[model samples]
Target: MKIAFYGSSLVSSYWNGAATYYRGILHALARRGYDITFYEPDAFDRQQHRDIDAPDWCRSVVYPATEEGLRGVLAEAGGADIVVKANGVGVFDRELLEGVVARARPGALRLFWDVDAAATLDEMRADALHPVLAALPDLEMVLTYGGGPPVVGAYEGFGAAACVPVYNALDPATHHPVPADDRFACDLAFLGNRLPDREARVEEFFLRPAASLSDRRFLIGGNGWETKAMPANVRHRGHVYTAEHNAFNASPLAVLNVARDSMAHVGFSPATRVFEAAGAAACLITDAWEGIEQFLKPDDEVLVARDGQDVADHLAALTPERAKAIGEAALRRVLAEHTYELRGAQVDALFKAAMAERRVAA
Candidate 1:
């Protein structure tokens, strides 16, 4: 199968939150003998943030960021068995839709893989960035990277023939724990860039905890966090790279996982970090989210924090042995169910189902 992915910044992991997520699915798909090509628009500053060289697993093609990007889309899209338009690419989605309608082969699988389902739909409804979402029924199928119930419910209500959630997953071989370095070692750490809507969530989930745990060390990593006055206990580091993620996870006494607007609104949705932190055997303390228990066993596989007190209590109570056990349990659960291999298998099943349905119609 020649699968073409058109969305987001695939070649760069610097500011891409979905880096691990994409790598997991694509690498697993590659292992299954599927030929994969990821298409990302070449935005300004893309050169500066180029982190990973194209690997053997999949080919990376950077198209122009403007209307000219359609040329790259048109050129590489040929001979693809499946062409995926991923959510949150922030450009030329409508043009890609037009290109698919005008140019794709009748048998070519055109899929919309929405990482942000509710947010994407909401924006479309509001005439926000992704107004092209309403044209779903004309596409082959829709797949969500997160959002379990709400996403499916909403997409179907909007008249989609097929939609499914493929949740963010882990790749154990790459993310297991390692010895920690002093620079990354801290009592508690949170990693996420600052976004407008998520700003309040950060304040509520992280900053308040930092204030409560003034005696302990807190580290914040990711971009767009500058120009904010944080408590002295909080250490603000700019974006951490993909290579340093495992060490960062290993060194933390406990890692904090905060979901964005859509993930939090939809229950049981797991972000890429949840898998990454667990795969690295880090005791994860995440903010109280709906449907969390459906994915992870609370207080065993992971710890849940609702407010500042919850965060403080979890950090203060983390014994080395206990934390290790929690991390181990989380890792085991992820390996069993949430690995990239499982995700790829799910996609295979879904893709075959769609193909068979199409065949029957013909």
Candidate 2:
């Protein structure tokens, strides 16, 4: 199958959090004999901050952030067996959503892949005329990276033919345990780009705990936190590149996964960092969200925290032995059952089944 994926940068994680998810799933699909051409706009300086060269698994096309550039990609999309317009392309999103569906060759499956389904659903609920809501019926299926059953129900309620949640999973080859690096060593470290919906939660789940445990070392790695106020005990490492992520996870005594407000409220949404940290065998401390046990067992493989105090308590009582034990357990579980190869197979099957259903209907 030929897949044309329109998304944020495939070569850069600079300001795009979805980069790893795209890489893992698409690479898995490629391994299963799918030919994928990733179309990403040359915007937000992501091109300059390329994390990996055009991957061998997929052909990458970086188009200008212009109307003409978008039209060119849409023209090429017509040749794909599956045309996917992912959320948050950072440019021409509305046009891309409508265009992929309209320009996709007859009988080609049109999929809208949402990396942030909770936020997208909120937008659709707030505005009846939201582009995605308008585009739902035209799409063959809505695939999400998170927001399991709730997201599926919401999309179906909005008239989508089908909605499948393809949760984030480890790409073991890319994210497995590595030797700890001094640069990322800390008691607790968090890696997330600061954004409006997530900043408050970051303050609660990360900064507050850093202040409460002033004696403990804390590190924050991601873009847009350079100017954010932090406790004296906290260190800010601006924009840790993808190459350093494994070391960043391994070096930290414990890594944190803080979901955005919408995700937490909607529940069942585990950010990509959860799997990445687990893949590196880092003891993960995640904010309370429903359906976490579906991914990692709490109090055994993972530690669940409801607030800053819970985080502080966890850190206060955690010994090096216990942290290591928990991390190892989580790693074992993800490697056994939560790998991208498994996710890729699920996706491949879904595509085949959807195609078969379409054929029968025709």
Best by TM-score: 2
Q: What is the lDDT of residue 129 in candidate 1?
A: 45
lDDT of 2 by residue, 22-98 (tens): 99999999999999999999999999998999999999999999999999999998899999999999889999999
What lDDT score goes with residue 35 in model 1? 91
User: Which one wins on lDDT?
Assistant: 2
Q: Which stretches of model 2 miss by more than 4 angstroms?
A: none
Local distance difference test, each candidate: 0.81, 0.94
Tell me each candidate's RMSD, in Å, in order: 1.7, 0.8
* Model 1 segments more than 4 A misplaced: 127-130
Question: Against the hidden true structure, what lDDT does model 1 obtain?
Answer: 0.81
